[model samples]
Target: MIKIHLSRLLGERRLTQADLARKTGIRPSTIGDYYHELAERINLDHLDLICEVLNCTVSDVLEYIPSHKRKK
Candidate 1:
């Protein structure tokens, strides 16, 4: 499973979803979806923009955990 750590990163950086959306030139709704992990799939271009605005790598916002590796 893919986990989005956007909320965690934003909280740590004291950034709001609207703030990030403005900085990344992305719509707040779209950013919200990503933040809440409600989107069916993530857009890489949007991810790049987010990383650029946040000044962080993709790993800072996302994590991949295989089913076998998931905690019981």
Candidate 2:
């Protein structure tokens, strides 16, 4: 599973979904989707924008875990 750590990053940085949307010029709904880890797919451009805004690398935002390693 691909896990998005947007919620954690935002909380650690004291940022809100609206704050990210304003900084990155991404739609608030889209930011909310990522923030909640509800997005099934993500645009690369959007990912780039998010990383830029968060001052983080892609790995800081996303993580891949093998299915066998994931808890049910």
The candidate that wins on lDDT is 2
Model 2's number of clashes is: 0
Q: List the residue pairs that clash in candidate 1.
A: none
Give a tens-digit lDDT track for model 1, residues 27-59: 999999988988878889999998898899999
What would the TM-scores of all predictions be?
0.91, 0.95
* Tens-digit lDDT track of model 2 for 1-72: 999999999999999999999999999999999989999999999999999989999999999999989976
Q: Rate the local accuracy (lDDT) of all candidates.
A: 0.90, 0.96
Tell how far residue 15 is off in model 2, in angstroms.
Answer: 0.5
TM-score top scorer: 2
lDDT of 1: 0.90
TM-score of 2: 0.95
